[model samples]
Target: MERSLSFRSVSILSPESANGRNVVALGVADAFARHGSTTIFRPSAASKDPFTRILLDAAESAIPLDDSIGVSPEVFRSHEMSMRADIVARYHHIIDARTLDSTVIVGTDKSPITDPEEFSLNAKIAADLQSPVFLAVCTLHRNPDELLATVHACEEAVDEAGSKVLGLFVTGCSPERREDTLNGLHELPYQVWTVPPQTVDPQSEDSIRQSLESFRQQVPADELIQASEEDWNIPVTPLQFQYSLLHQAKAHHKTIVLPEGEEDRIIQAADFLLARDIVDLIIVGERESILERGDALGLTQLHKASFQSPHDEELLAQMTTELCRLRSKKGMPEEQARKTLQDASYFGTMLVVLGKADGLVSGSINSTANTVRPALQAIKTKPGSSLVSGAFLMCFDTHVALFADCAINPNPNAQCLAEIAIQSAQTAQSFGIEPRIGMLSYSTLGSGKGPDVELVEEATKLLREQAPELQVVGPIQFDAAWSPQVAASKAQGDPVAGRVNVFVFPDLSAGNIAYKAVQRSSGALAVGPVLQGLNKPVNDLSRGAMVQDIINTVALTAAQAD
Candidate 1:
C-alpha cells in the first residue's frame, strides 16, 4: 500500500487559550485524535495559570475518543503533561511508542516557555520517538537570549535521541527580524525555513484552512537519492593516449622500428605502452645503459627489450659487405663503407634487410634525407620501380582515401607519377580500400591547359599500358575527381573520374599542400608519409611527432610489411 504522510499544526495562540481556558492543549488533543500521530504545540506558559470554569466545555470538545476517557487536572502538571497526554490521546500514544510509522513530524513552539528543562524534556520525548524533528520557534527582533535557548533545546533533543534535525522553522518574526533569525540559526547543522508573518486575520477560518493545507504538503518525505559514481566512464586524455602507446609498445608488437629510443619522452612512452600491455617494444641502444636509465627514472617495472647499437661489430661487418657489393664499382673501399654503415640508420636498414624487423621508423632525431639515404642505398627500390614515393592514408571516421607522393618525388615526371599511381593503388588495396586512381592536376579532361595537366595525362596513359587491370583517369581537377556530377559532365567516359579513392598528385608541391588543405579543412586524420617502393617497409617520422604518432607509424609499417 502507498501510504501518505502529512504534518498537522496545533494553534497555540487561540482566543480561548489566551483567555486562560487551556483551549490550545485541547485543540492539540483534538488534532491527535483526527490525525492519529500529531505534534503538540508548546509555547511558554507565562504564570501559574488557573483553569477557568469554561475549560470543562473546551475539554469536552477536545476529546475525540468514541467513549469518554476521564483525566484529572493534576495530571496536567509539567511532568504529568507528557504522560497524561499520551494516555488520553490516541495520536500521542501511537507517537510515544513509535508505532504510528508515519513519514514526517512538525512541532511548533508558538509561545515563549521560560523553563529550559521543560522545553528540553518535551523535545527529548519527540526525538526518542524516532520521527524526523521539524522545530518551529517564535523570534522577536530584540530577544536574542530566547532565540539562543530555543536553538540549544533543539540541538540537545537531536543529540539525546541520535535523530537528525532536518531544519528549524522560525515564526512570528517581523520582516526586519527575519535576517537576524536566519543568522542565529546559521551555526546549527540543520537548514532553516522562515515563516513570514501572516498579517491577514489569523483567526479567519478560510486563512487557517489554506495555511494548514500548504503546511501539510511542505513536509519532506524521504531524503534525496544521488546517482552512483560507478556509472561514469573515464575519458581518454592526450596524456593517456601517449602513455598507453609508450608503455604498451603497441607499435613494436607489429614489428616496426623506432629511431629515437633514449630520449625522455620516448622512454616514458615506451614505459606507458608496456604498462598498458598495448605492444611489444624493441629499443635500439645499449641494453645495459637502457635498463639503468629506466631504473633511474622509476620505470623499473617496465619490461626490458632487445637493443642493438649501430656500432655493433656484427652489424658493421654486414653493412660493410652489403655496401661494398652495392657500390664497389664507384671505388668505395670496404673500410670506408664499414665506417659509413656505423650510423644507426644503416644499422636499422640492415635489420630490415636481414628479416629481423618488419619495418623501420626513424627521423625524429635525424633529418629525413639522412634517414632515407641509408634505406635507399641498402634496401633499394622494388623491382621495375626506378624512384620511390610517399603516400598518406587520410581517414575520417570510416571513410578512407589515399593521397600520394605528398612527401617524396618533388617533381615526379610521367614515369615517376605512373609508378606512384600504381604503387598507391596497390597500397590502398592492401589497406582494404578499392583503388580508383585519380591522376590529379589543375585541369579536368582538356578544359584547362598546363604542363602539370600534360604530366598527369601522360602518367595515366603509361599506368594503363603498364598495369592494364588498374582503373586510371586524370588530368582531372580535385572537385571533378571527388564529385560524380562534375566527372559526368567533364570526363564522361573515364573509369576513375568521380568515385576516385586514390589521389595521385602531379608533384610533391601540389600533393603536400592539397593533402594538408583537405586534412585541415575537412578535419581528416592523416596516417602516413609511408615510404613506398622500398624492398621492405621503412618509414620516416616527423621531428615533432608524439609517441602515439611513432606507435601508429610502426603499426602502419608492420601492416605493410605483412
Candidate 2:
C-alpha cells in the first residue's frame, strides 16, 4: 500500500492565557510539527498576555533567528520590543509578501481594536497576503459582546479586503457555554471549533498542546493542495474491493463511464488512472466538444479518454433491451421502457449489466436518484436479495472492518437487517477477511431491553436461520464489538464480540454517525457504503464526492463483479 503524509501549514497567533505562552506555543508548535506541519508563530503586542509572552520566549529559544541573521542589539528596553522585532523579521522571511499561497493563519488575540482605522489597515495587509485566518478566542473570560464584536471587526475587514475567514477557534469554555458561543456566532459562516473542557487546561501545557495538535491534524492539507491543482479532486483512498476493481479494470483495459465528464477534477483523476494503467476511461460526452473545452482549460491529457453521447442508437437499444428484460415481470409497455432506458446513464449502466465493461462510474452530473434509479429498475437485485444495503470498509492501514448501511435504506426491517449482515459478511470474506458479524445496537444482548434491542435480536435470529454458516452475534454495542476487554466484561461468551469484522447497524442514522465517529476518533479509512445484493455491483456516491471517490467506487464494483 502506498502511504503519503497529509500536511497543513498554520500560523499561531495567541494572547497570554493561564498556561504560560512558552509552554502553550512551543508545545503546540512541537505537536503540529510532529504531525507534519511548518508552524509560523506570530505574537501580537496589543494584549500583554502571559501565554503570548511565554510563546514568544519559547519560539525564540527553540528557533534562534537573530543569531542566524547576525543581529546584535544591546539590552532590549522591553520584552515586547525584542519579541515583536524577532517575530516581524521572522514573519517577513517565512511568509514573504511575495509568493504566499494557501496558508492557515491562527489569530489568538480577541481584543476589540480600539483603533478601527489601524485594525482595518492591518486586516487589509493580512488579506492582501491571501491567508485563511482562524481566529482563536476565549469564551470564559471575554464578554460575549466583545468577542463577537472583535470577530466581526476582523471578518468584516477580511471580507472588504477580499480575504477568507476559514473559521473561529473558541477555547476555555464549558460545553454548554461553547454551544451558546457557537450559536451566537451563527452569522459568521465560519467553522466553529469549541475546545472541550478536558482538552483545555490552564495549568497544564500538555493538555492545550494536545488540543491544538488534534485541530492541526484535521486540516486536510494534502486534499486542499490537490484540490488547488485539480478543481474537482477529493482526497480518498481505495480499499480492498475498490483496489481489486481498479486492478481488474486495468488488466482488461475497458472503458469506464464518467457522467460528469467535463469537471477538471474528474478529468484529472481519469487521466491519472489511465496514465498509471489503472483503468481505461470512456467519458460521456461529444469528443470534439469535450476536447475543445479541455484544450481551452489547458488540460491536454483529457483528450485521451474515449467519448460517446447517450443518443447513440446501438447503445440506447442495448440498454432498452436489458432494462425491458429485467423488468419483464412488471408488465411495462416496450415503447415506454425503451424511451425511459435511452438516457446516457441508463446506457452506461446497461453496459455493466451486459458485461461489455467491468464497471460503471458516474454521479457527478446527476443526483443519486438519476444515477441509481435506472440501475435499480433495470439491473435488479441478486436472486435471493429483496433489497439493497451499503457497507463501508473502514480501514486503519492493514486493519479493515466493515461498517454497513451507512448510505442506503434509511430504516431497515428485521429481514432487511439480516440480509445486510449476511451480505456484509460475504463482502468481507470476498476481501480475504474471515466473516465475524456483529449486529450493532445501543444495548448489548438483552441487558438493556427496548424495541430497538428486540429488532436487533430478531435480525440476529433471522440471520441464523437464513445463513446458518455465518458466525454472528446480535444486540452488541460498538464498544463490545471492537474492544476485547469490554467484550470479555460485557459479552462474556459471545464468539464474535471483540473480533467482529462486519458491523451491521440498526439504520442509516446509526450507521452514518457510527462510522464517522469511529473514523474520526480512531483514524480509520472508511471505503464504502459498498452497495450489496445487486445482481451486479452498483453503488451511489455522495454529491460532494470527488474523482478519487468515483475511482474507488469503480474499483469496488469491479472487485465484486470479479
Candidate 1 structure lDDT:
0.58
Which residue runs does candidate 2 get wrong by more than 4 Å?
1-255, 296-304, 328-331, 520-523
Residue 497 in model 1: lDDT: 85
Work out the TM-score per prediction.
0.53, 0.54
Alpha-carbon RMSD to native, per candidate: 26.1, 16.4
lDDT at residue 135 of model 1 (Cα atoms): 51
The sequence of per-residue lDDT tens digits that candidate 2 reaches over residues 384-427 is 88887878888653356898988778999999999899889888
lDDT of 1 by residue, 1-562 (tens): 1223433222222111121112223322333434443323222221222221122122233222221222222332345434423322333332333333122222222244344354444443343232344455656343756776766765665555334444555655566776777777678765554544432223455644444343334322221101101122222222222222232334345555555666655666567546645545567777777778888888853454557776578767876787888777777898888777667777677777776777787877877787788888878898987878889877642246789999878988899889999889888877657788888888888888877778888898999898999877777888899989988988887777888889988888989998889888976667678888888888887777666566556656756765
